[model samples]
Target: MAESPPLPPLAVDIDGTLTDDRRRLDHRVPSLLRKWADAAPVVVATGKALPYPVALCEFLGIPTTVVAENGGAAYVERTDELRFVGDRRAAEAVAEEYAAAGHSLGWGEVDLPNRWRETELAVSREQPLEPLEGIAARHGLEVVDTGFAYHVKSPDVDKAKGLTAVADALGIEVESFAAIGDSANDVGMLERARISYAVANADEAAREAADHVTDGTYGDGFIEAAERIRAGVD
Candidate 1:
């Protein structure tokens, strides 16, 4: 019999998966990431700005891709190819509407990453999501809560779209990959990949969408996922 194909690359979330809610990477994560990189491609899919994810990839000394701005942009490290995927104007409009609602918005309190994002507007999660969804709907936009913040983005653009693009760029089948994340933004990608994991700390919806929920939380769960993938458990 022919040998089964090797597992495809891993597409991982940044905040709340590889790092804690406080935004610190556990010491174990980098080594596990390095090992994974040695075995196959590791793409960092995140709601963070391009530079931030790129910086992490750099720090790891791993040649990997990044899907940033909640699927709005992706960078292929080895090729230095950058692709922008979402509606920037729509995102800005959503931000404006949210600001008009008199809620503290952008670069205040908890959303420092707001200034760095160009295609997704970061809104305070403290603001009720129901009203924010209504505001987003007015412009045909979408709102996703990423634990730390709420993101205003194009309804059609999301992590799944970004992951597909990265898979295409790498000439790999999307179904061959594994996706791990812990928030509403990650649900789409989780559902799309053949092998999907929701870390123990994942948002309820994300946990529901995933094929497996890791036994550990945050970095620990991510490490567990890596082990499961290597073990070929469905």
Candidate 2:
């Protein structure tokens, strides 16, 4: 008899899903990922900047591409190649306007990896997103709140689009991957994956979009999803 087909790749969001907090990754994540990487490829799809995801891929020793800037850029770790597709001019213009108008917008509680980004402008999540939303709408831009940071980008850029780019580069179908996420920016990829999971800590929108909600939070939830994927338990 023929052997069963191989499992598809695993795509994960960086913040809130893979890490316990902004500064910490789950201790169990590396080992579990080592096992999973042997079975299938792993991709980091996030709203983070290029360096952060690229560094993560390096640390994991996973030869995978990273989707950064909330889909604004895709970086191939092995080749050290970076591609930028997100249009941030309009967003930048709007941000400047808001700043000039006396909004206290700046990088949030954590250090911003994309503070010097060219494809997107991110501000602290502490600010009201409503005004930015209205401003973005008028300028044909999209404002995405990732819980930790608010990303202003083109409407065409999103996590799903980033996943599609990675899948294309790997010669795989988007439906062949499983996705894990925990925020509004993750919604598109979550809905696009063959199977999607949201951590227990996810917000309502993400939880609602996911195929399953893991009982654990943060890294634990991610491990739970990975195990279930290995088990083929759906």
Candidate 3:
């Protein structure tokens, strides 16, 4: 189904799409994903770090175009093009404020989520959002709850920008991509794609942004959307 007649490329989110309810990888998807990779160019867009998306694609033997750290960075593997669009220091400042208050990120104690994160910061959902939001506002940053964690980054660095950057690098249009996801952080990317879908379990913002909602949940929903795309269903 590799775009024989030039259908749009595909942009996918990993955590809620490729993972099950527990956020663990679904064994069924890797094999099915190769067929997806064959359908069109794939962009692994996620709020995760740069290494996460790139490594996942490499392991799966898929082409790598990543919008990582919620669009804080965009990297295209074939061209060796990499662009970062956010200020890391804002997140660092938020960390400092948290430290002063005797708190650490990602449930404290050597915050693993932010370890490889090059830009912005991710706080554990256990942290209170009010104070964090206040701190973020003061620093001109915004906090997004991606269900897995609380992401603190710039409003200007949404996934849409990252998708656009990746599309341009591939000589494609952002509007020519079909996107899928299940969280608020994915809203911008969903809105930018020509056709977008929300997994049945998607959060409110994501569902609202998507043009369609699949009957399946999580990975199944993703696969369903991919099949529809391959079948050329509008």
Best-performing candidate as measured by TM-score: 3
Q: How close is every model to the real structure, measured as TM-score?
A: 0.91, 0.91, 0.94
Kindly list the per-residue Cα lDDT of model 3 for residues 1-234, writing each as its tens digit.
Answer: 464455468888999888889888778777766666776788989999998999999888888878999999899987889998887998899989977876667555666678888779999888788889889888999999999999999978899999999989889889999998999989999999999999999999999999999999988898898778766777
lDDT of each: 0.85, 0.82, 0.87
Q: What is the lDDT of residue 187 in candidate 2?
A: 91
lDDT of 3 at 226: 77
Model 1: residues >4 Å from true position, as ranges? 1-7, 109-111
Candidate 1 has which clashing residue pairs, if any? Answer: none
TM-score of 2: 0.91
Q: After superposition, which runs of candidate 3 have C-alpha atoms over 4 Å from their true positions? A: 1-7
Ranking by TM-score: 3, 1, 2
> Candidate 3: what lDDT?
0.87
- Weakest 10 consecutive residues, lDDT, candidate 1? 103-112
How would you encode candidate 1's per-residue C-alpha lDDT over 29-118 as one tens digit per residue? 888888788878899999988898899989998885999988998989776788887777877777777668875564666656776687
Q: What is the lDDT of residue 175 in candidate 3?
A: 97
RMSD of 1: 2.6
- Residue 124 displacement in candidate 2 (angstroms): 0.3
| Candidate 2, superposed: residue stretches over 4 Å from native | 1-5, 78-81, 108-111
